[model samples]
Target: MSAIRPAAVVVLAAGEGTRMKSATPKVLHEICGRSLVGHVLAAAGELEPENLVVVVGHAREQVTAHLAEAAPGVRTAVQAEQNGTGHAVRMALEELGGVVEGTVVVVCGDTPLLTGETLARLAAAHGGDGNAVTVLTAEVPDATGYGRIVRDDATGAVTGIVEHKDATDAQRAIREINSGVFAFDGRLLADALGKVRTDNSQGEEYLTDVLGILREAGHRVGACVAADHREIAGINNRVQLAEARRILNDRLLTAAMLAGVTVVDPATTFVDVTVSFEQDAVVHPGTQLLGDTHLAEGAEVGPNSRLKDTRVGAGARVDNTVADGADIGPRASVGPYAYLRPGARLGVKSKVGTFVEIKNTSVGEGTKVPHLSYVGDATIGEYTNIGAASVFVNYDGEHKHHTTVGSHCKTGADNMFVAPVTVGDGAYTAAGSVITRDVPSGSLAVARGQQRNIEGWVARKRPGSAAAKAAEAASRESDGEG
Candidate 1:
């Protein structure tokens, strides 16, 4: 297959997005586990641009660091002050240090919903029509915040883009608005940008003015109206951020559902692009699968569970749990309120019952920690039974120690293993025991005090107690009967 020819891409990420009311750079805000600029970068990368330059200003350091990590090898240009889109584009052209040849695509950083397919279409339309500039446009019910597209009524040629504040009544009523995305003939972008002026009402160099310059220079200006208006939506505040999140999530979930994964409630299930579900896997409502989580076939998670960087093998079931950096083997059962921390590993058919918390531990196949247990820094052999309310005392203020239980062992309720300790195969520990020493194979360990009988102890403790009153009443009744 032939490689796609590279085009120049200039992304404007220099605005502070002041209305977003955040300390962080607006383009750094995230939705669907990806920052807004990250989404734009992903789209731009699809084009295989020859020269990729991101214009950075407000919180430039943060944005630069993020770009270094998320999208490496892409160059950055500094827009020293908050001017306007035209000025930002001019900075990008200067950073090229040479001519921007074939084509140039200009995009806003805060449009996370923009897809590579739409960008490809825009570029194709511009190059095909031999247009000097192609303005990506959208038709919406309300065009209040967008620039109005002014067209020559009879010839149907794009005359100019009038900002809302500068538009007259007739122009303001135009439903078709400029989406702030544009494709320009590379040779014309630099010349047209230079001719753009800041004489408008806002006294800012509007890139919209570039379209007028190209038109007056006897160049053909075109428009590519996007099919989905939301594709060109720009987020300026939290409300718009939330709307974009909903749209992006719906798209992700729809794709997952079509791929044979079963989602019980699409509305409440939040899955990152990094999450994968094999066929027959079920994800219930209120589940968040984040940070590279994977569920094998037939694995079920949810009813309010949250997992990050965890793996659930086939046929495993996790309910109402919170797990991070853990692994559950096939057919294993976890939760109803369990918490599994980093390094927790459960073998096949094993059970981590209700109200249990485990960390840095491995429970062998067929083992069961029934309920109300805290196990950390431990290892258990197969077929072991850990009774309810049992604990592995792994910490002694300064450092943590290990506990090991061998195969076929039965640990009684309310037992505490004071580490570092070991229990051999087939060993049994009595209820309410606290074991500090190791138990040999096939042995029984009892470490609690024995019970004692003390008759009349309650009578001695309380002279006028209920027993004394009952005894006197019974004697009086017997005498009366006699």
Candidate 2:
């Protein structure tokens, strides 16, 4: 492909997308971490055009808000009325100040699978052939809803395109359909759009009419057939959206596998476009790696795990866990059923076991927080063992506080640490204790009350019940022994 930059790239997103049945604009619907229009803009941005414009309508506020965050520098044009594609491009041209001399590439916002490489090829072909207009076309098994490309029989030149609604039975039989994507000579496009009339069956101006108008003026018109028809697929509803997502995910996973990442079950392992993996990283079945998650070499995430905006260091393993905005250090292990919330950090060789939840806490190297624990807003030092069913009671009504457990500390099972407290290095806390005060180094802290047994309580409290009957039987046995 030649290094030809487009003068302007106009994205047609102004359609109401009635078929989508969505309150959100069709172009704002997402697949694989990117909205439909966002994907199109990304591909168009690859051309490095002097001007990039998105024509927005029908929920423009939502789409505009998205663009402000996602692509702040790109310009937008408004199509106030629900006109046709021709009117949408006309608005984009007006936004560009109507002075474009180089190649102008136009693309539909709904086509997420269209690649930058293909767009570049279209632009190159348009420029190389000196064509007044060049269309991106595809030959499909079904042309039910697409525009049919009509070509001259003898010269093989494209004559015009007919929308499926207006196409005759003979023309509808043509397998080669217009993709609604084009690369046009900028000045000629502007001149031809003016001649387009709202005389079609839908009473709207059709961009396809421009091709016919330009051809009538003796200008060369060409069509570039896409290699894969799937690349031209559009998303209008939930079903198509899901299908597109599957295709895109397959592509992403295949590329990752080719790059040396091990995906145990590609079909069941879902990954976002923003996720990255180092060589030797393993993702097991039913795992979803989303957002900016990164897995270092030798990291293993398993059978039912979802990690979002998290980083897993080398040699770490996360099993059946759900983590968000967390960091797992090298050689660390997390869960068969753990939840790691934002700001949770596990150090080297650390372990967070089954049914544990960690939030806004840091577990030091060699530390272990075993099953049935909730550690929140706390810091635990190296070589420490946090026993099962322990709770870091860091919140009290209005404010949140922090707890600190020092190096080599041993916290017993069912222990609770009250916030603003500290356990010094080598200290031990007794089982079932609630430590409200700090413990000095090398000391044993016990905050639990002495155990006492209440005799005959069950008999008095529950007469004629199973527990009371059992107590009476035991009392009779005691009397016999006496």
Candidate 3:
């Protein structure tokens, strides 16, 4: 195969998205766990554009920040005002410096369903026909709110793109609509953009105007209709966002199930763009896996759990837990109500009981952390037992510290360890102990306030004592004289 031409991609994301009624940038709004711009950029990345320029305006900083983190090395151009599409392209052109040659693909950032294959096909058609402009078109039942493509009857070439507001009655009936995506010869696009005028009904320069300019200049302008119209749907509000998300989620979910992953309820289980599951991995209803989470073979997740940036090894079971950036080894079981924060790792066959919170800790194989405990910044060795309400008190007012409990160690209920402390191998901590110092290997540590009892204390403290009796007698004598 010949080398793919070095094409430049310009993503138009300058709209204020006023209809979305959100302070966040429109393109930054997430669909299926990724921002809309992210999906668009990923599609563009597949084509390996020589230079990717994203045009930003409203909430430019937010858009730039998100793209920078998600897609490093993507170039950005700013449109300072709410100008029309043609003006947005002009802003990006200024950032291009020298004249651009070869094919250039322009896509809307909000069309998350447009696949890389569709873009590649558009480019291939544009190059194959030697056309100056190839407009990506789609035929929809209702073309309202879209530009209609007008073609010459004899040559079957694109004559012009007429906006809905400016189209005549006959033109408005055209089934073929402009997809707002295009592949253009770079030099011709730059020259034609200058010739477009703001004399249309909207009093704004429409990028569609360039089709007329190119045709009038005696250049071949063509149109390639997309096989699927839904791919070009643009999101302008929350309802549309939902529609786009549904489309994206359906595609991802179908692919996962076909790959042998078991989704008990695909409708209720939400998976992000980067989540993957191996064969025989079961995801129950109400499970949400977000941000690069992976489940190995034979792992069972949820009956209503949320996992983020975590990994589950083979045969692991995680139920009703909220886990973030944690690792669970094979055969380990976690939660009906547990939280595993960043850096928490459960070893093979270990169990994290209900209502427990573990953060920045590592539990060794066969270790069991029973109900109602908080384990933070600690290390527990193999076969250890941590009783109910046992807390590794890792924080002092000024600083945080670590606690280490060695292999075969047993901790009783309601025990507190003030770190930096160590309970050595085979050691034991008695119930109700407040440990502040290290305990040597094979030793038992029990620190608690001594219990004391006082008998007959209530009787001795009664008010009817000698002093009270005298006062009562004086009062009786005074009342009798009165």
Candidate with the greatest lDDT versus the true structure:
2
Best by TM-score: 2
User: Where does candidate 1 stray beyond 4 Å?
Assistant: 1-4, 462-482
- Give the per-residue lDDT of model 3 (tens digit) for 5-71: 5468899999989899998888989998889989999988888988899999998988888888989
TM-score, cand. 1: 0.91
Local accuracy by lDDT, each model: 0.91, 0.94, 0.90
lDDT of 2 by residue, 1-482 (tens): 34999999999988888888988889999988899999998889888999999999888998899999999899999999967999899999999887578899999999999999999999988989999999999999999989999999999999999999999999999999999999999999999999999988899989999999999999999999999999999988889999999999999999999999999999998888899999999999999999999999999999899999999999999999999999999999999999999999999999999999999999999999989999999999999999889999988999999999999999999999999899999999999999999999999999999999998889888999998988898888989953
Candidate 1: residue pairs that collide? none
Candidate number with the higher lDDT (1 or 3):
1
